[model samples]
Target: MPHIFTNRLGGVSSGAYESMNLGVNRGDDPACVRENYRRLAALLGMERGRFALASQKHTDIILRADFRHAKNDVFDPADFVADGLVTRERGLALVVFAADCVPVLLDGGEAVAAVHAGWRGTALGIAAKALRELGCAPGSVRAYIGPSIGACCFETGPEVPRAMLGLMGAEAEPFIVRSGEKYRVDLKGLNRRQLELAGVPAGSIEVSPDCTFCLHDKYWSHRYAGDARGSQCGAIVML
Candidate 1:
């Protein structure tokens, strides 16, 4: 399995998008976004037409994809909406886009998955769902949690912490920090905990040290750049 977590680098988009904007609907020029996809696929040594692009919606839905879902055009409408995509097909890439949201890659030998986890998707356990659907046992799977808004930059009202606590209970305490009237939740830690709860080995999960918000220049951060930002994508292919 070969996987990549991209940042905002190496492409033709301009302005707030700058370069390397992989997202199709973030107001970047359609042709530029399409070219960016081609460039990405070329770097991965695969045809851009063979990639299965995820239509994310902050849901736990993990769709199983193969050549049946492949398309050359990244801007084309998707037949399905899912936050995660799993596949066993070799040379077929699965991609999920994100700005500040988490991008996770799971390698389970026969199958691999690309997951986008915003707070809602994380709470819904999209990572665990991908593993379960791929028939991958937790211990056998290796996970890479990509850059996103870290706890230090993720300040929210009580509702966000309450939701996290609802899913993780007291186990979510350390990741949730009380900062005056707001709470800063470590989404990466919480997502890892959820994966562990679903049986993924804690030792097998690797969390990115970079935070999108903290390193806003290196990566795109929705919190830092709202709707005017471009998005980075996490992609995986079974070789």
Candidate 2:
């Protein structure tokens, strides 16, 4: 299986969506976005039709995908509104899009999942949900937390940290840093903790050091670029 977290390089989109913008609704031309997807599909050595996408509303919904859900178009409405997708079916690639939010990839050898974990999704424990849907023990899953808005740049109000506390109690404390009246939430660490709590071995997870907000040149950041940004997608295919 091949898995990759895309950046903002390559492709035909121009202006705010300078190049390689995979998002279909961020004001980028639909033709360009489709072309970008074709490029990504080419790199994966699969046709665009093999990709199964998540609708991504920041919910914990994990859809089980197969050939029926596969689409060649990224702009088409998904059959389900989900933040995570899992499958044991080979030849179907799972993809989820994000700008500043975290993209987590999970592989259990026999199955694979792709998740979109923003603060809301994280609070909802989307990571664990994906693992559970794979029908695999957490300890056997290998997780990779992709580039996202790091805690250093994710300043938030009480609601974000409070949601985490409500879900994880004191276990979420270390990942939430308070400075003045605001909080800095570490989305990556919070997701990792949720995976660990679900029984995933700490050593089985890998976290990317790249921060989307800090490295806006290489990645798109909704926090840094607002709604006029392209999206980065994390995709995984079962071999």
Candidate 3:
């Protein structure tokens, strides 16, 4: 399995997008976005045409993809809406976009999945859903929880903690902190806990220490740049 969580480096887009903007709908030039994908494909040693991207809506929807879904052009409108993509097809890359949202990559030996987990998706346990979609024993799956807004800066309203608590109960407490009238949530930790609860061994899961909000200059961060910024991606392929 080959996987990569890209940053805001090594691409052609400029302005607020700067370079390495993989998002096609972020108002970046289509030509530049395509060239970015070319650079990414070259780095991965995979064809650009074999990439299948997710139309993320912050939902828990996971779609099983194949060669038929591959598209070389990022401008192509995604026919399906899903926050996660799973595939067993060799050479076909599964891609999920994120800025402040957590991007999770799963490798189950024969199958791989790329998931976009925002606070809503995390509360829905989208990672666990993707794991179940892999149809593999959780202990055998390897997971990577990529960069996102960390607890140090992810202050939110009560609804965020409420949703997490409703889904994970007491297990969600330690990852949350009460900050006056607001709350600070650790999305990466919550996603990791979801994977562990779904049966993935704790040692098999790797969490990135990088926080997108803190490292906004290095990675795209919605909290830092808002709609003026571009998006990065987490891609995986079974080869």
Name the candidate that leads on TM-score: 3
Candidate 2, lDDT over the whole model:
0.90
Q: Write the per-residue lDDT of candidate 1 for residues 107-180, one digit (tens) a residue.
A: 99889999999888877777778889878778898999999999989998998888878877898898999999
lDDT of each: 0.87, 0.90, 0.92
Order of quality (lDDT) = 3, 2, 1
Give per-residue lDDT, candidate 3, residue 141: 99
Task: Supply candidate 3's per-residue lDDT for 29.
Answer: 92
Candidate that scores best on lDDT:
3
Instruction: Please give, for residues 8-77, the per-residue lDDT of candidate 2 as tens digits.
Output: 9988899999898988768889999888888888877775438888888879989988888888567777
TM of each candidate vs. truth: 0.96, 0.96, 0.98
- Name the lDDT value of residue 168 in candidate 1: 75
Cα displacement (angstroms), candidate 1, residue 149, comes to 0.5
Q: After superposition, how far is residue 101 of candidate 3 from its true place, in Å?
A: 0.3
Q: Candidate 1 regions off by >4 Å?
A: 47-49
**lDDT per residue as tens, model 3, 92-176:** 9888999989999999998999999999999999999999999888999999999899999999999999999999999999999
